[model samples]
Target: MQYTGASIRKTAAHFNIPSFKAVSQWERIYYEQGKDALFKEQRGRTSKMGTKRPKKPKTNIETNEDLLAQVQRLRMENEYLKKLNALIQKRERSEKSTK
Candidate 1:
């Protein structure tokens, strides 16, 4: 493997890889171990045991109501933060004018 001193991102982009981390990992493995190391599969191949989680079923109306509630909460939070910021700026302006 001839590495021409190219940046990891550039090499990843050249190979059309979405994540540069994968390219860097491969590069590290290639440089540390040998080319043969890259040929081996990932460590967790044989066991393939994954955690299972149960899914909760929610009705469409309930889901929509939950989403709307979250949206309203976020909007109220945004408005409160805006007002707080305006008050802080006003206080700072008043302090500056007094000095």
Candidate 2:
């Protein structure tokens, strides 16, 4: 089951399992962590700490329309913020020139 260097040579000699490195990896895992660790159970990128899971998409038609309107409102807010930031920078530069 657990294949070491000695085991790899023995297995290769007797049974012809070609990858010694792969066999050695299996051996190390089995010896150190046991069999359950070898199985691939978890899938996809793990969520970061303190970050909430993304909300599921709304299936209801009314809810989807509401969300779309909210998204447009948020986009307008972002554009307003950008223009405000540019105005503030222009003011800062003007003040610096005056001084």
Candidate 3:
């Protein structure tokens, strides 16, 4: 890998590489082995702790109290809708009778 050409040209000459320049380039990358001599750059695969499990967030009793109040508000809204529906039904019945 460091000074790959001189040995590769000799090996290629023995096996009969077509051109001296081609053997020189091949030896520069890989002297004896054809494909394995190329150095692959792999500097991006290290773990950076950015994807690790995070600490649990803090939860107070006030947050629970806020959720309970929201539930109570929804329940009151459901009751109001039921009363409004009954009033509409009664009005429709009275109008039908008058007609």
Candidate 4:
């Protein structure tokens, strides 16, 4: 209420608010609508279009070994790409030196 023309930072600090942006929004709402609007629910609707579908759980068929193998394969591919990039950069440097 003391923030009629006062800075938002000072108001937030006076109230020990983590984010000054919240104070800025509250001030905007207070001016536009009223102080009662601040007491109302500020959260938006959870779902407006339709109800959300829950995620399906993986079956027991997905074993730990299969997950580990997949991770190893991805790591090998990432290492191969890094080595290939280094070789390409080396070749480019050599070409530049020759020019």
Candidate 5:
């Protein structure tokens, strides 16, 4: 499409594509890296050096112990928060009663 000297918007409208910017991007990629670039997966953020950053694992499922430790930590946090809330409510009630 770009080789014929047509504008990005004209080409996009002719092909019924939603965005002219997307057509311009495709043209840029095609010119820089050939047709293969159009089919390649382009997920994730690129690093400062222009390479794809390594993706981190979604979950740390290396061992049962790790999962158990996370659950225990979360339980402790929940208990602490509940105790703090109870103390705040008690103080508020005492203050209201005195007033």
Candidate 6:
């Protein structure tokens, strides 16, 4: 009825339905997926089993040597950050003492 020159509001009113939005949605579903799509059970909330979470992709670090190299790099970064923090604290203390 909506596709045949009838307005959504008028069609909804004539059918004694609550809102024109519902009519519009039905028309959209009908056009997109056809009539069979309307008869299928609607899923309100997706169950944990129904949803498949995408897996994280594996990195190029496949060997033990690669893992060790990454750990060493992280350790070096951590040491650098610690040294920077200590320097900042020492500078602040010196400034405070001078004041």
What are the C-alpha RMSDs, in order, of all predicted structures? 21.9, 15.5, 8.6, 19.1, 15.4, 11.8
Q: Tens-digit lDDT track for model 2 on 23-94?
A: 677767777988887785556778777878899987765777889999999999999999999999999999
Q: Rank by TM-score, highest first.
A: 3, 6, 5, 4, 1, 2
**Residue 70, candidate 4: how far off, in angstroms?**
55
Question: Where is the poorest 10-residue window by lDDT in model 2?
Answer: 1-10
Give me candidate 2's TM-score against the actual structure: 0.38
TM-score of each: 0.40, 0.38, 0.44, 0.41, 0.41, 0.44
Residues 1-99, model 5: lDDT tens digits: 646888889999999999999898888898899999899988778755867789897784568888899899999999999999999999999999999
Which portions of model 1 miss their true places by more than 4 Å? 43-99
Clashes of each: 0, 0, 0, 0, 0, 0
Q: What TM-score would candidate 3 get against the native?
A: 0.44
| Model 2 clashes, total count | 0
Q: What is the lDDT of candidate 4?
A: 0.89
Q: Report model 5's TM-score to 2 decimal places.
A: 0.41
Candidate order (lDDT): 6, 5, 4, 1, 2, 3
Query: Which structure is stronger by TM-score: 2 or 4?
Result: 4
Residue pairs with colliding backbones in model 2 are: none
> What is the Å distance of residue 61 in model 3 from its true position?
11
Q: Per-model C-alpha lDDT, please?
A: 0.87, 0.78, 0.73, 0.89, 0.90, 0.90
